[model samples]
Target chain A: MEIASFLIVFFMVRYIRTSLQTAVRFPEWERILVIVQYAASGLLAADVFLDSSITKWLWHLLLLGMVGAAYLLKDFRPVRNVWLAVGPYILVSLFKDIAKLIDSDFYESISTVVEIAEIFTLVWLIATWVSTQRQQKALEKERLKRLQEEEQSRIIAGQNVMLEQLVAERTAELTRQKEELEQTLTELKATQDQLIQREKMASLGELTAGIAHEIQNPLNFVNNFSEVSVELIEELKEERRREDRDIELEEELLTDLTQNLQKITHHGKRADSIVKGMLQHSRTSTPQREPTDLNNLADEYLRLAYHGLRASDKSFNATLIMDFDEHLGKVSVVPQDMGRVLLNLFTNAFYATEQKRKTGLAGYQPTVQVSTKRLSDEQIEIRVRDNGCGIPKTVLTKIYQPFFTTKPTGQGTGLGLSLSYDIVTKGHGGELTVETEEGEFTEFIIQLPT
Target chain B: MKVLVVDDETDVQILFEQRFRREIRAGELIFAFAHSGEKALAYLNEHPSEYVLILSDINMPGMSGLELLRLIKTTYPAPPPVVMMITAYGDSESHDQAMQLGADAFLTKPLDFNNLKEKLKSAL
Candidate 1:
């Protein structure tokens, strides 16, 4: 019986130690249960060797305590296996011990039944533990799969946001570029307009220059012949006085010839002035500035331009109004160039009023007003205004552009205002601007630096 | 004194002759006419040292008055005839160029005969 108890104690210790290490169940309780089992086995061995009922009772109590502890803490999943395996063994042993204590006759049969039940309980506990381990491994694999899927979705979301931002940026850049292109197009159009105007003016200038050159030679001959005739008349008069052969009729005839010669000289000078005006208009010579009386210059051109138009159209007439600033003295300017500018403005003003008169509007009086005033110590202003068929608003801005004209095809070259603009602004460092309203009035303002 | 007038215009000869008719009648002055610079040069070659004054126009079809003036000033014999240049253009550039080419006087066209007569009287 001593050897048997030692063998049972040795096997129990080895089984509890192995289960505590290898099984995925009952870690804390298994440690406590191992202590209790060793105590019980020691007590049982001591009882069998010394024939002590106290030691036997102690062993049974320890086994009962272990079973009760396992039952009480059975909700702990790892401890559940310990409770399931040990609870049946403890109950069966208690029953067999109690049966032996109460009635010795049925103890052997009861021991046999308890042993079979304990074996069956141990097998069921092991199978339950194996299935629980397999289920836990599957749960761990499912959690890992879910984590990987979450990471993939997060990366995709980030990429989607980045792509959206890139698209938005590209759209903004395209819009900015479109605005820049529109601005450049507007600037190019303005430049092209300017270039076309310059080209037209250049060609017109060339044509007029050729015409002026051809007219000069014949005009010079007219002036020279008239002058020489006047001189010859004087010589003939001197001869008559020296010879004392002045018969009253011959003297009268000679006097009449002199008057006729004077008349010729006068008309010849008039034609010469017209030819010179044309030449000055056509020539692109460098400006020669000199101190000139602005009042005299303006008044002279006003009359010249008026008579010139009258010569062309005898029916056309307009009242000329002059308000010259007597206080404004000589201003340094290229007289020929400034004269051209004034002549052009005066002609346009007369033409406008004449056209208004030709409309035969009753109670309508055509008037052209030329006024000059000293604006400051360093500047002068000249304004030419006409109460006539004024400039239309549609063509106001384009008036200074060469080849822009309101007159019929052959009547106007369209370069008068453009040339005047160049003369005032470019040649003299002055400003030329126009103010006009349709069918009412037009005014050209010239501001020249002294 | 003999005066040579060189010009391309034929009418210039008639005008000069009419203006100086009294002087020509009195035998105080004589006139010679050449239609071009080349003709004037040929005349001078034949009648060397005969002309007291030579009046030439600056602009001509061939051998401009300035070129003729240059040749006359440099190649003529000592006591050369006084050469005067005239032009329709009165610009300072032409005046300066003619003066620099050794022209005795520069005059502009629609000539003042009184001034020319005075200059000629003083020169003689």
Candidate 2:
């Protein structure tokens, strides 16, 4: 009976030790279960080779260790799972107690029941072991799946870092290109300014011939008046030299001489002014601001440009039509630059009219008109119009481009309008625009901000 | 002799009066002045045969001396007046054109009054 009980106790201890080992997280409890199994094996050896008293002591020690193992296992997992081992342990104890209580006749029947209970305990151990094995296999597969997911995440993180580096490199390259383009734009602006200065100087050269002719008109008056003054002085001297001078004749001669001297002085000053005007036109100094009357400026340029044309082609002439704004106030402008722009516009207007006159169309009196207006408190407008060969549609857009000319090769430098446009718009923050018809007229409008 | 001088310069009136002062005062030559070609033509139309000689500046605005000469020679109702074309331009082209237009003489500006007097004497 003791051997049978020992066998059941030993298997129970072995089964729990094996099951607890699979719960490796609780290694201390598995260690306790191993000690319990060792105690049961020692008790089995005592039951087989030692005296009954020593065997009984070993049996009690084994039971004490089993109790401690059961308590430790219960603390690790579900208390209900503990009952699988505890219930069999209690049944084995009951079978040991009943085996002692049963008589010879009753023992035969009870022993069969005890054998069946032992077989049931063995089957329970086998079933629990199989389920533990399956649980361990599932846990192993989950661990492998987690490792693969972690590796995939690491690869994705590395790709993200590479993409960030690529974006940084492209941004640096774009920044370099942007700086280069800005430098190019600055260089273009400087070259444009140089070209504008050259064009202004070229126009001054073209005006030199016209300026010479204009000076001739005033010089003619000066020379004639001075020569007449010399004759008047001689006539007075002759009157004075007479033995008895006629008072009335002497007074009259003296009066004529005085008048002649005054005329000479006046015409000399006029010649001086014309020279001064020419000097102003040809000046290459930087622009200086002054208050200027547009009406007076326009009127003066109109004649200057006309004389310029007439001097070149003696027969060329036009009817000058001008209407100026009486209420237009003096505008602040760079006088020399503004004067050049006005001269260019007036020259163009007269040229157009002269060309129209050459066509010899009957009743065609060539007319060039200029008008000035105070368009608003912030703006002043000057319009120069000519009834002449109008600008063609195709070349209208290109008119403001540098070196674009419609005139015969030697006649036009082609920088007049382009330079004028820059002076008005960039220099003064103004706008230059044109309106034209194919055969009727061309009007250039300059809008200046006050 | 009645002389009509046409020029845009107002100073010409005084200059002519002073230059021909003796002839004017003695009444050997009577002087009248017009500032433009149109005025000169109007003066002629108003007093027919009053002016025997016309001295005109060729470059006057509105109507040039050449145009005035052509009009006086071909269009005037009375016997054609003797016309002289005067200009600042002393080019041969202008002198020839003025001569072809029936001008009695062509004169350049800063006019040589002595030469003018000689030409005037011969033409008269």
Candidate 3:
């Protein structure tokens, strides 16, 4: 429809050339080309109406070529010259047609001009319609292709987002699985530790029972011998009191009596004490819990523990500083269990400092400091500190874990600290914490609720 | 009073028997012995509460002393004999569990005879 309107306007300007040019003021060459295109169209119309195959075909071809040339030509002057050349050819044809009959020629001329104009209008309309259809088809195809491309890209981008989300979900699931596995491993480790502790107890119980049994015999002999010596001493006393004593005999008997009594008592008491201590050590008695004074308990173990270490290593001259808070009150605890915990701490401190000395770490003298304080009305805090090669930060977490140890295998069952931790935390509902700096010092702090 | 000493180790039985030899002669103490929980149960079934005290080790191969104590406390409620649970480990859990199971006292290995004597004298 738009093309037909444009063609109609173009024909209007061509037919009323002089007046339209005067109104629109177009360039002279442009007006001349418009006039020649109109004339060629008119000639093709006349030929079509007259049924002149050669002229109509040739004229149609010529019109198309002229339109193509208009677009192709670089300069308007060449087109203007060609139209000016064709103007003279038309006049010559008009003049050469004088031999024709006047009456028939007049009708032919009128009819031919009218028919040509009608034919030109109709043919131009068909051409305009066909070109417009082709353009519309091309535009529609382009629009469909653009829409298809857009939809394809949308699907691809959606798939990419889905893939990324799936990957994230899978990663989160894997992380959750890993966490569960870690928790299970930790629980299994705890169970293993308990079993190991039970095993240690069994062995120690058996060993202690055997030792106590063996030592009881010697203790009985000492006690019996001591009783005989006391009886002999009484006999000597009775003789001395009843008779006038011979000086040499009396002196010798007195000396024998005193010396033998001393020997008997010395061996007797020594054996008795050893048997007693061994008996205490061998008994697999269950813990008896009571409200216990933590400070006093700490002081007691501080002496025994230090002395025990000293007995084992006479060269261990580490100074043990006891800083006990006398005002600290009682904690609900199993005294024996608490004693063992304290023993473990002091021994560990002593051994750690001793190790430092053995390694000649920084050439510093070893020291184990035990301190206790009343943290609050409800809590008591005890710290066992040693100037030793501190555990590495990496190993600190596992220090209280059973079977994790840096000491030589013989030196550690790896259950000392672990058992102590369990005793403090699980047994007494307390807390045990360690603070350490590698190559400097380590401190085990215990907090018990009063 | 007759006392049953249950332990896996022969040395334990010997020590117990020896320690109470004078009392046994005076008719003040009597002794029955079992090396394991099964044997101890068999003896108890035949002679119920003939012994007043049950002393057993906690870490036995089968039917630990705690288990035996539990059984005796639950099944033999009438004149249920006093039970002293003995363990070398001395963890809180065993102590608490034993007490909850109606044990008279809990004793750790390396037993102080005086302490045991006091506990037994009180319980018996």
TM-score of chain A by itself in each prediction: 0.43, 0.60, 0.45
Error of 1 at B44 (Å): 63
Q: Best DockQ goes to which candidate? A: 2
CA error at residue A199 for candidate 2, angstroms? 2.6
**What are the RMSD figures for all models against the true structure?**
20.1, 8.5, 21.6
| Candidate 2 C-alpha lDDT tens digits along A1-450 | 456447646665555555445356667766666676676777777777866755654564465455445656455353225446445645664554556456656766677777677667757755775676587579768878888888888888898899889889989988998899899889988877676666666666656656665566667666776777777778788888999887898788778777877887787776676566667766667757778887877876776777677666777767677899998899998877788888899888888877777788888877889899999999999999999989999999999988899889977878899888988999999999999997799999999998
Runs with alpha carbons beyond 4 Å of true place in candidate 2? A1-187, A322-331, A371-383, A390-438, A442-450, B26-32, B37-44, B47-54, B69-83, B89-107
Better of 1 and 3 by TM-score: 3
- Model 3 spans > 4 angstroms off: A1-139, A146-289, A299-327, A334-340, A359-371, A386-405, A413-443, B1-124
lDDT of 1 by residue, A82-139 (tens): 5554455556555666788898778776676766775665556456556655775797
- Cα lDDT tens digits for candidate 3, A198-224: 644533443343334334434544454
Interface RMSD of 2: 2.0
Q: What is the lDDT of candidate 1?
A: 0.71
Candidate 1 reaches a DockQ of 0.04
Docking class of 3: incorrect
Best by lDDT: 2
Please give the clash total of every predicted structure, in order.
Answer: 1, 0, 16
